[model samples]
Target: MAMMKLEHVGIMVSELERSMAFYTDVLGMELVGTLDHNTPGIRLAFLSYPGQTAQLELIEGYADRLPDEGQVHHVAITVDDIEAEVARLRAKGVRFLDEAITTLRNGARYIFFAGPDGERLELFQPPRG
Candidate 1:
């Protein structure tokens, strides 16, 4: 009952720099900060929108081999224009799992794509007014 809002979602990554670039350069998230995790051989990096507090934490050196779907099933980022966002990512060589955007019963549209570390990422558009 004390929970206020979703703070962050952390995903394991192999290479910190590469994953950071994918989220920052390709996805357009701003790099919040990077730091050495308490555990040895582990590093942490946080990213978010230019002026937002909620973050996506990228953790490195947690696992030697990552599964195809990675640890997290998928991380969805809300978008205003799903089509334009898909086109933008496609131009950057991003691979999508879904051939076309999926429309939900409530008119929400979404599409899944692979991240640098093979983590699933989704772009979602809520119903229009």
Candidate 2:
């Protein structure tokens, strides 16, 4: 078993530039990086504050359904061992959304699961050595 820490909050947006500006300019958070995120229908922008707080993920969906639907997408929690954590959660009868773990350009590996209320939850790990 390993410690889990709150990582980032993902939000789907209509406009990437506007959302990025609002987060960086208005919110005063620094832009960590942007990526295609290894998945379709999303343009990922990761931002963070000055200290050890959770980062903000701006996800701009390809489809124009942001106004109708919602912005908040998912919550990510970082783990020391993603495989071990996933196995542990699975033993408790947790349902995984992804067939396999997803690794991004930054080397972070993660898997999505559903919370009690159907909210998307992520278990993340740093780039593997």
Candidate 3:
């Protein structure tokens, strides 16, 4: 019935490994995991405080160019029930970037929708036990 919490913020990077080092080695965040993204040519790495769930997702090979200020791919929010949330949003005329929901290798499901200013926003449903 409501969004659970902010899942993670996705950022576009030109180099996945470099960004991973900077975030983990320099910032002291722990590398939670990495995955070959479902999208071709794209890679993903997650980092966060040790023993905690990942709070940042770094993406590479998504785009050839990123602005000097950096690009935020999207802000993800966790939802208890993705299907219901999607339906609710659709009823309000929310614009979705894609029609199908994507399930990750770990069983996490997500879908992206356009925000008010066309900013990307994602709704994530973690794997259910």
lDDT to native, each model: 0.79, 0.86, 0.92
| Model 1 lDDT-worst window of ten | 1-10
Task: State the lDDT of candidate 1 residue by residue for 1-129, as single tens digits.
Answer: 122244556788889999999999999999987877545898878799988867887989988988888675457677788888888889999999999997755576778899998888778675699
Best by lDDT: 3
Q: Least accurate stretch of 10 residues (summed lDDT) in model 2?
A: 62-71
* Model 2: per-residue Cα lDDT over 1-129, one tens digit each: 484689899988888899889888998999988888676767888899887468988888755776665668799998999889999999999999999998888798989999998999999897778
Off by over 4 Å in 1: 73-129
For residue 74, what is the lDDT in candidate 2? 90
Q: Mind giving the per-residue lDDT tens digits that candidate 3 earns over 37-109?
A: 7888999998898876648999999989999999999999999999999999999999999888999888899
RMSD of 1: 13.1
What are the candidates' C-alpha RMSDs? 13.1, 1.9, 1.4
Clashes of 3: 0
Clashing pairs in 1: none
Ranking by lDDT: 3, 2, 1
